[model samples]
Target: DSDSKQKKKKKSKASRSDEDYVQSLNSREDRNKSWWDDFRESVEQAEPEGTGKFLFLKLLLNETCEIGDKVLVFSQSLGVLDLIEEMLKIASERGEGLKSSKGFYRPWRKGRDYYRLDGSISGNKRQNDIDAFNDTKKARLFLISTRAGSLGINLFSANRIVLMDASWNPSFDTQAIFRSYRLGQEKEVYVYRLLAHGTMEQKIYGRQITKQALASRVVDSEETGRLF
Candidate 1:
């Protein structure tokens, strides 16, 4: 519905102008993620609120990982996924190899499956990413934006998912969970909902759930959880 944002500009030509614009956007995203990753430790410390989420996910995933074990991290924006990848990277870097300490297992995620939140991916690219995700030798994490990657995707390879941010639409949450909770999921699907306490996220998520049933019954439903 209205929750979907407009598609990014697309170019059908090999012009330098189009290439430059896309490159700039990519550069901006890279710079932003780099800055955030650098500040993530301080941010975590300043915001102890993440403890509830971190602990919850740790418990859900059992802090252990295996090949072909996929995880889809759901957030409101694409930028959040980038930050999460950095968090995962940090986790993997701090002596997180297989034969390490007590809680040192992060999944073997690839560089390509760090997809944007939407369906901006081309058909070929999507399949390649999916293939890698389902590959037993390569990937285990599939970080995605809730708004973009929630529907029409089979994420049955994962037994767990982490919702980085709650949405007003419970169906949005439902669709996101289906990425793992769908058919062929061998294990008990565990979905962790992360809500930022004492923020607009809490109120919006609560109100959104209340409206979920009602909204689905009508045609002209109000989409309160639209893009920021």
Candidate 2:
């Protein structure tokens, strides 16, 4: 079994190098520049707001992922997603930056450019996003909303997930987590839930739990968890 795994890894690596090189050759950017250099310029020049959210995004892009890695990002709210798109534009303009209050941010991962979830993306573009995230020839980041990407989406493409905020229902979060946790993932799926310390957010989380538990099923012992 170990030997078989080694062979599989070797085959995957060889195929990836071939594809990445082909993509490099096919790219129309100045033949003088490699994809990495172009990517760096984009990330650095995109002018993102210097907020806590970008701080987290900086860390996320810095995570270690090999070629063909998949990443599912759940920002939870559309407002936040919009903010992320703004940040990404900054990343594109700035090349690579880590604008944080603590003064620590660096780029370590070799990645393909990212794709933000948008209404305009569908069909093969959607499937290609899924595949590229898995293959790493095209996807380094996948920005998604939990509600949309959670249902009936095949995300075996990559093995990393970051939920900018955990939904009110743990089950909703569960659905989001399972996108990668489903069958055929060769790597461990990492789930990160971000919560602000000592805020109204905690109460919100508790209420969501109570509501989802009720919606999931009926138990006589539970009462209300909603704001009603």
Candidate 3:
């Protein structure tokens, strides 16, 4: 009887917690459309645009091209990656065709050559995409999923990294950054972690920093072994 009572109490607590989490998630989604619109406009806007993703685009159009630098763009959500791909595609359609190259096969001639790697991409195809991004000047951007691109890949060619969104765990974001900032990287790497203003993203980014600090403190202390 005592065991049954304890189990029921735990179950009830879990249920209430899940319900509250669902409510919060629902509320966040309600504000999703505006966030996406802002993001799209930022990416699609022409040169000399204002802040946000537009700023990154401005840099890409101005700096990356002028200097022959590459960029790696990371996002945790596959859906977000898809949205970025769509925006890039639209930009391509507006006569932003690939820069002229000799002896290199151009797959899709959408303006601004680019590639995508996520959970949905096949291993062979992913490697192909990476090879293309690394070897060709035409392929200017690599769109990657944070979890998918975090480990076991070296993208030293890209000096610029755009974190389309932040992860709750800062280490994951760190891993994404290192993909470009690692050794063999000749240029000074630039990383941009974008967070939507006045949104849940900002809240999560603040929480991530706090979590990272706590983790560092725990690991650095002599008491860590004893506590564990």
Provide TM-scores for the models. 0.63, 0.58, 0.66
lDDT of 1 by residue, 1-228 (tens): 433432222334323222333443565577656566655787674432356665565444435343334467777655455455555555556644222134445443456433433335565776677666665433446777666677777867777688888876778788888888867778877777788789988888777766774666587665544432
For lDDT, the strongest prediction is 3
Give the residue spans of candidate 3 off by over 4 A. Answer: 1-51, 96-112, 219-228
What's the CA error at residue 32 for candidate 2, in Å? 39
Predicted candidate 2 versus true structure: per-residue lDDT over 156-216, tens digit per residue: 7667788877676677678878888989877878777666766666666776677676765
RMSD after Cα superposition, model 2: 15.4
> For each candidate, what is the lDDT?
0.60, 0.61, 0.67
User: What order do you get sorting by lDDT, best first?
Assistant: 3, 2, 1
Q: What is the lDDT, from 0 to 100, of the residue 15 in candidate 3?
A: 67
Number of the predicted model whose TM-score against the real structure is largest: 3
Q: What lDDT, from 0 to 1, does candidate 1 have? A: 0.60
* Model 2 segments more than 4 A misplaced: 1-49, 65-69, 97-112, 118-120, 208-228
